[model samples]
Target: MMREILINLPIESHEVPNLRELVGWDGRHSDYPTLFERCNFWAGLRVEKNNELIAFGYVAGMGLQHGYMEDIIVHPQYQKKGIGQSLVKKLLQESERVGLEIVTLTYDSKHASFYNESGFKPCSGGLWRKKD
Candidate 1:
């Protein structure tokens, strides 16, 4: 039997390590803290079994019209279990709740099918990275 998954917001800072592990990110990095500080809305999903954090995602809004989904990840063990879809759906709902007219997320081409199934469509965009 599969364990129930619970999704909630206002996640505690102590859970960052688990999230880093889930996404293979460096726990020592301050990116997670910055995300919590900067994101307009965020959510995390936990497995009820051991109360382990198995998924996380966040959204940031530019005014009330555009929302960007960021840092979506699910533990490899939890992939293909609908956890990712649930996370995306939760972010979309939050975006709608805030009156966002457009929602966007960036993902690798290999993951296009997943986002496409979740109602995302192909669109052209550009990115510019500032040099350190």
Candidate 2:
């Protein structure tokens, strides 16, 4: 059986540290100010039976031509059990509601197959640069 994940409203700053720690990949740990500036984004959180956050996904740029999905992470302990899929599905539905023409995301090659299964197409066009 699949465990239910709940997305509670009014997410707080206290959750940021835990979100940072739960991520398994290397990412810039966003502070409260950064998170606040991006609060227009939405996050879906998976809670354990005892209400601990076990997984999450961040979605931004609603109603735009290019909406972005970022920080979709499942705590290692709860991975490979459809939590990620459920979260993505919810985000996609939300995007469709907001008139987004396309939803895009960037992920590691190792997870390419997973995203493919979730209906994300692999594209070969883009210029990316990181600032130091």
Best by TM-score: 1
Error of 2 at 26 (Å): 5.2
Instruction: Write the residue-wise lDDT of candidate 2 on 15-83 in tens digits.
Output: 655665766454455555475466335555646465666666666663467688877777777788888
Q: Give candidate 1 misplaced runs (Cα > 4 Å).
A: 1-8, 26-28
Model 1 lDDT tens row, 23-119 = 7776645565666777787777767667766777878866479888877878888789888898888888777877988988898999999999999
Judge candidate 2 at residue 41 and give its lDDT: 55
User: How high is the CA lDDT of each candidate model?
Assistant: 0.76, 0.68
Q: Which pairs of residues collide in model 2?
A: none
Q: Candidate 2: list runs displaced more than 4 Å.
A: 1-8, 26-30, 36-40
